[model samples]
Target: MPQHLTIVTHPLVSHKLTIMRKKETSTAGFRKLLREISLLLAYEVTRELPLTTETIETPIETMEAPVIEGRKLALVSILRAGNGLLDGILELIPAARVGFIGLYRDPETLQPVEYYKKLPEHMEDRYTIVVDPMLATGNSSVAAIDMLKAAGAKNIRFLCLLASPEGVARMKAAHPDVPVVTAALDRGLDDHGYIVPGLGDAGDRMFGTR
Candidate 1:
């Protein structure tokens, strides 16, 4: 398990998750639920952000107020499905800087190979958050982290819609310094390497296709 794995089964998250779990849920519905869950997940993900006091004027009187402390945050989407989770997270943290990393697995080796990547400036100074809908084999998530590290991202966090034990273990071994936050961690991976009870290819479900 990840050093920090908050499996959110909250009523809101669970309800939306069930709607998405149904195989008959329309592509649009799946996409929408992912967005809802992402928003809820954002609540859990940013729970520990430090706060600071600031001087501000209230409607009634001028007084000191509490506000988010430290530097602006960064969000990295592990494309292309990661983009699904990214959309909702962005809603909650609209001011957060965004980044992307696209990777594919080698046919024979089943290892990760980077295809595309673009990140925000001064990533080293930002608290980075990387997201993906599913963490099955953990290949892509690990590879995505490697890309961020290569670019000098220090304070990094991982977010996902669903995860498998294999993926969780892989992340712990590969990037223990980083924390993983997910909504659900299912039984395990399947034959072709997808989460066993997972909703299916998150990209396909969200986009409506094979």
Candidate 2:
């Protein structure tokens, strides 16, 4: 309903997302839910993909089958929480190429700075999907996009588990060309800039840290 943003409320995804939101959920469970949700989310993101018909001989007769067009896609994960979504998406698109972009948030300024970055060759030619778990302030997500654009990626899509209004605004202003996909857009960010009522630090929750 929010332009390019697609919020999925499917029963299965909603059920797992609710569990992941619960404070009582275990680290392993959180990780698993992220994976499952990522897979489901990926399905929605690729729903409108172009398909080509292929002629194949069946056991009884020859028939035409539909297959995805183009070469393998490029999946760029904005580490480290992005890695969480990466695994699940990979399970669905095993042939997808994987890339990593590491960003660190400065506690005082609350800004994102790059730590590491690695992308595949011919990124400009491949459809790129950038993965991140939480799009709270959008600082990290914005930085990641800027980095990607600087590198040769023209076609890009941003996928996240949850997004805040502020983050969405920031992205819309910064990279309107890139569509964003998320499960839910939370209330907003807390004083510390974390998404209010958010599941806390995504990486921490996934790794069993305080």
Q: Which lDDT tens digits does candidate 2 get at residues 1-210?
A: 225677887888878888998999999999999999999999887776668999999999999999877766889998888999999999999999999999989999999988999998888787789999899888999999898889888878899989999999999999888889888889998889998777889999998876
Q: Ten consecutive residues with minimal summed lDDT in candidate 1?
A: 1-10
In candidate 2, how many Å is residue 145 off? 1.3
The TM-scores of all predictions, comma-separated, are 0.94, 0.94
| lDDT score, candidate 2, position 196 | 71
Cα lDDT tens digits for candidate 1, 37-141: 999999888877768999998889989888887778899998789889999989999999999898876767768788899999988888889999888899989
Report the CA-based lDDT of candidate 1 relative to the real structure: 0.87
Pairs with steric clashes in candidate 2: none
Q: Output candidate 2 Cα RMSD.
A: 1.7
In TM-score terms, candidate 2 sits at 0.94
